[model samples]
Target: MTIQENRERPERSGGEQSAAEPSPPDAGGSPAIAVEGLRKQFGSGPEAVTAVEDVSFSVERGSVVGLLGPNGAGKTTTIKSILGMVLSDEGSVRIHGIDVYDEPRRAYAHVDAMLEGARNDYWRLTVRENLRYFSTIGGVDPDSIADRHERLLDKLDLADAADQPVRSLSRGMKQKVSLASVLASEADVVFLDEPTLGLDVESSLTLRRELRRIVAERNLTVVVSSHDMDVIEDICDRVVIMNEGRVIADDSVENLLHGFDARGYRVTSADLDETVVADLRDRFEVTEIERSGDRTRVEVATDSDGFYALTAFLRSRDVTLDAVETVDWDLEDVFVELTRREER
Candidate 1:
């Protein structure tokens, strides 16, 4: 379900686009986006606010990197600086090896942004009008990109709403239009900030799946920033976690989850004996013990690697093996663990 469908907007088929226009990522060594020592602050004196400090990261071409953080984490500020919407007090931002500060026009030529989503569009204009208008303003001849514009409307399921006034459509529908404009653009890199903010569950999931599909099919480099962890986990190949205007963690989702996993578990068995229980407590960090009708459950703080040791201990006392499983952590859990306050 796309924004149009979510809002019950009409549908219409658009002209087919040529497959030759937008090229895939080049096989070069330079990253699609590079930010080093990015620093930004607002105002001065004792009350000056630091929005981004010491943020640095590089995004590989054809990769989706998620920028995550709690409120005031500098996620938006970092993105704005990269897009040149905000000036950084220090550090450098390079888009496809072109320094934005040195060559704003050339660097921004390869980039397109969908910040603030639907709010970026002109509410009075029809969906098609907005697309063509942006196509003309973004340094591309509207006539030359007509096929591409039509294809975006069709691809994003916005064709039906193409002639509908943006003000009459739902907010989500308008956001779809904004995304369609960026996707149809011939730009090399796209920055999406909270693309799924107002979307429903099914629509959000649908958008996420479509985004992943588009990135794979187009081999486009995308930087997605959102508070939706599920969207990030589902769409991003790597994540750059931030907290309090600084990057707290940067790595692949799998690696972060692995690093934060505690390997805790609970085991229930009916044939337990006091001797074996004592041995189990002595051998492992048993956190809790519970007893029910002819059954006992033991919670152990150990990884799957120690399951064998636990089994051996139980077997030595003639206890039957029941079950063993490794604990798992989702992206949200890892985010909380890394971003939470630390104690001495």
Candidate 2:
């Protein structure tokens, strides 16, 4: 099929990527989503609240980038500005290299958003109906996306509830429906805000796995915003961390962990004596220590060389190391540490 032909054209449902349009055609290899010097204030005069400030970042094509920050950190505001849902007083926002500020229709055509608050779906409509409705509004012909719709419904485990009213569904089911609706839009880039919020442990894990599957299979780029660091770490290729309305740290998740986790170590062995434990406390920052039966486990924060010194110290005290391993930082640790430094 010609690349120029709309994948949404329903007559040709035989392709692998019909569940969604192929990733947006490259615009001279430009960034998929781009924002620069974005500034937004909520009100006029001295009482105004600055929601975003000097924020800038770019997401390359076919990459899932996490947009993270603490509460009131301007994450939401920055996202809204980029989507053109809220106007910014300054800066440029682009989607697929098309300026969202100046051409919303053209830019948004390549985008899909699965947001919270039930605002993105019709409560009264059945799951399948809502998918079709969203696709229609998104400029997709229903016939064109029928197969893709079925594929998404099956992938999201919504096939059984395809005809059930969203209003009657559980919160988790409704959230899944919202995701299906976005995927049915056949857009290359999707913005998901708090996709795993309020889910049970199993549901969260299921959703995360399904999301990764969809993004990978469809070759889509996703910008996910969520407080669930597990979801971010599991699915995101890179992260753009925010603080006080500014881009604080932007890097790959591996690099972030490597930088912060370099100081972490875990030592496990049997019969750690009081003297050695005391020396450990005095020499390094110990976060965890447990002793049960003959086994003792100590987790500490120290530099790369600090572990060598730690092992030497233990040996000096007749403590034989059974197992020593590097402890990696979870995304939460990296998030907190980076934002903390920004605050300080």
Candidate 3:
């Protein structure tokens, strides 16, 4: 099915019976989502293209996980397989201990997703009307959740525009509305893709802060996929990184950033001439160099031993160190390092 059809699925039609209360995942503790050895391929024989291979991960209840990878790294395929949008070639996916393929309705009764930014929203419907409509389709009574919708609008800063047609709103506002619609439903598990795709700095920050608040308030389980490293680092408790259709790193943001041993440094010196700069480049991995008037700054990635040797060489050349700063590694740095290592 197309993405639009998938987004609108589990829909109730006229004359259909009211949906039963969503069954709990399992009696004992079960993960909100679990995928094991998932693999997917397209085409046949020599033309076959494997989009995902042996990707595995689990997300606990009431937590947020980020699914990350460059293009063609299987992030999309893996997500689709878990959501039952694509049938995988191997492995298993369970939501709350209920097999997705075996008991799709029970497994996904309390799940909702917002894919491709603002596309999930209805352009002609007012913001409030869209929320009520989605809630109804999700087997929820819109009137019963009216207070919840009000709170969502206030928290997302859409209260003023609650009655405005969605198409009349700005792009960033529409994105916020799409997210609100997903939360408007009674779904406990949510998937958000590129939640902040086209927002200004302030708008992005607002959405990020409100999303975290709403997730915590509801104890919701979230799986987010985005190209924004800062968004992942700020919002996710853990990250699952994919490279070449395989799982390369799965750990908390803190562990991944700290576990990486490579450290970078920036040094500024007024005495760094062309000779010194060339010599420094030859001896170390100098990633960047900048010269402003009489001051020159150099950035290098190295270990403790290499760092000491660099200082010694600079001293020998009579280069006075005007300033030195350690460059702390962020999520982007760790991601690049891991993906590059896999490629090598």
Candidate 4:
């Protein structure tokens, strides 16, 4: 069949089911996306490399989740396996209760994706035309979603250039146009990879705010992959971080930031000198030390127990504590700490 025919074809039925088809989904209560024991490898024998191994996670309905990793962390492979673009060597992926590998069309009926900051949009088509075209191919009547297209164009700052050809727009404009196309489809589940790439600071902020609003308004279940930690922290309800083909952390952003023992403490004492600083270095990981007049301040990384021990040591040395404060950590720090631990 031609590509056009395949795009327009209805779901295959009855005897068309494959021999490896998974069982039907549960009638009640299932996650929007569920991946279990997913594993994928390349090559063979001693030369083989495992890109992903025993990775599993789930996305609940109407939640925005961030899929994060450093380079070569198997993020792309996991996403492809979930989208049915790459067949996994093991495990299963389910979308809204239906197994993706068993029934791809049905599983992806309400799904859309913008990969690598772009979609397969027709560059020759006008901005509005691309939106309508994508909506049609995504199994929605173009006329039925006209209002959505208009809102998307307006919200994405593409309304003024709606009639212009996509090829005529700037790279950032084109990126926004691609996102508009995906959002125009009214898909329940969306996967956005680097959705803010190529956008300027103002445009990036606009996209982040607008995306959060749109997701809440439409109850979109979204999986976003981006190297921008700020974007992920601002938009995602939870994050799943991977390193070296394994999931190192999966939790709410708040927990990941404050729950780890990686917290740093800034302690100021009036009696600290070069000798005291050296003693601190011997006892703990001192990140910073500053001497101002008669006071010395030191920053140390440690947990609560270590902090207590530090206080005891300070008292033993008769160092009068002037002030102590906790240093705040952001998502990037947490991500680095988690991934570094995995590497160690």
Q: The CA-based lDDT of model 3 is what?
A: 0.84
Clashing pairs in 1: 10-160, 11-160, 12-160
Error of 3 at 114 (Å): 1.0
TM-score of 2: 0.86
Candidate 2 lDDT by residue in tens digits, 1-344: 11112332221111123334433446798999888899999988999999888998899877899999999999888877776667899999887888876766566666777655535567788999988877775556888879988987876778999998888988888888877787677678888999887677887787777777777887788999999998999999999999888889999999898775365788988858777788889988999998878889999998788888888888888788888888877899899989999999
Candidate 3 on 66-173: residue-level lDDT in tens? 999999999878877887778999999988888888977777777777776326777788999989988886778899999999988988889999999988999888
Error of 4 at 104 (Å): 1.1
Candidate 2 stretches with Cα past 4 Å from truth are: 1-26
Worst 10 residues of 2 by lDDT: 8-17
Q: Give the root-mean-square deviation of each candidate in angstroms.
A: 7.3, 6.6, 3.3, 5.8
Better of 3 and 4 by lDDT: 3
Query: Cα lDDT of all candidates, in order?
Result: 0.76, 0.79, 0.84, 0.82
Candidate 1 residue spans exceeding 4 A from truth: 1-28, 141-151, 266-322, 341-344
N/CA/C clash count, model 3: 0
Query: What lDDT score is found at residue 104 in candidate 4?
Result: 80
Between prediction 1 and prediction 3, which has the larger TM-score? 3
- Candidate 1 RMSD to the real structure: 7.3
